[model samples]
Target: DAGVTQSPTHLIKTRGQQVTLRCSPKSGHDTVSWYQQALGQGPQFIFQYYEEEERQRGNFPDRFSGHQFPNYSSELNVNALLLGDSALYLCASTAGGKGHAPAKNIQYFGAGTRLSVL
Candidate 1:
């Protein structure tokens, strides 16, 4: 089965510009989450999408938004980007079922799209 995948592998942008990143969830999965990983910092959850709705979100500005399609793929859009936005944008997928089981609720991540804002 196919796993989560992200696009552009790498990206470069300037301050005040906008950027969009894409993601494909793992097979038989319906949940996708986006995360931001700075050079030396752990990944910080941006948001999670399930059934085309955001089910959970982390501490982030309004500049960060996302969408999930019926195909179970997702896209993250950032408006008025900042140099601080430079980081690795990771996409995670999980089979949303039986949430009571920790193993069944685990998330799988992709290599991520590296965004560099100058």
Candidate 2:
């Protein structure tokens, strides 16, 4: 079975351009979250979506947005991108619900898309 997958593993854009990143969750995963990782920095949560609704969001600006489909796949869209936006965009997937192992509750990340804004 294929695990989580992301498309166009790398992207480039001008400071004012926009970009879209895609992700398909792992088998049986019901939750998807987006994260941004700057060079040499740990991943920072962007937002999370469950049951097709945004369940939580991080400190990112309005330029960072996401959508989850009924099938649990998700997309991240950034508009009016800035040069500082250059970084790795990560997508994480995990099964939903409680009663799972604390360790099992951790999100599994995809290889991530490296975005470069010039």
Candidate 3:
């Protein structure tokens, strides 16, 4: 079975442009989450989706939006992009089953799509 997959491993864009990144969830995963990782910085959670609906969101602005398909695949869209938006866009997937173990619910991130905003 395939792990999480992301398209356009790398992306380049100018300020104010928009971009969309895609991801395929891991086998049997029902939850998809997105993160932004800047160079020398840890990833910041963007949002998470389950059952084709957004379940939770982080501190990102409204410009950062996402969608999840019935198949559990997902897409992250950034609008009116800013230079600071440049970073590695990571896609994570997990079953999120009922469990008390944090480790068990852990989301695994993929190689990520590097975005460069000029």
Among these predictions, the greatest TM-score belongs to 1
Report how far off residue 65 is in candidate 2 (Å).
Answer: 0.7
Q: Which stretches of candidate 1 lie over 4 Å from their true place?
A: 98-100
Clashes of 2: 0
Q: Write the number of the candidate with greater TM-score, choosing between 1 and 2.
A: 1
lDDT of 1 by residue, 1-118 (tens): 8889999899999999999999998888889999999999999999999999999999999999999999989999999999999999999999875355676689999999999999
Q: Provide the overall lDDT of each model, using Cα atoms, as 2-decimal numbers.
A: 0.93, 0.90, 0.92
Error (Å) of candidate 3 at residue 20 is 0.4
Model 2, residue 22: C-alpha shift (Å):
0.3
Score every model by TM-score: 0.95, 0.94, 0.94
Candidate 3's C-alpha runs over 4 A off are 97-104
Q: Enumerate clash totals for all models, in the order shown.
A: 0, 0, 0
Cα lDDT for residue 23, candidate 3 = 96
Pitting candidate 1 against candidate 3, the one with the higher TM-score is 1
lDDT of 2 by residue, 1-118 (tens): 8888997799989989989999999888889999999999999999999998899999999998889998889999999999999999999998865348775477888999999999
Worst 10 residues of 2 by lDDT: 96-105
Clashing pairs in 1: none
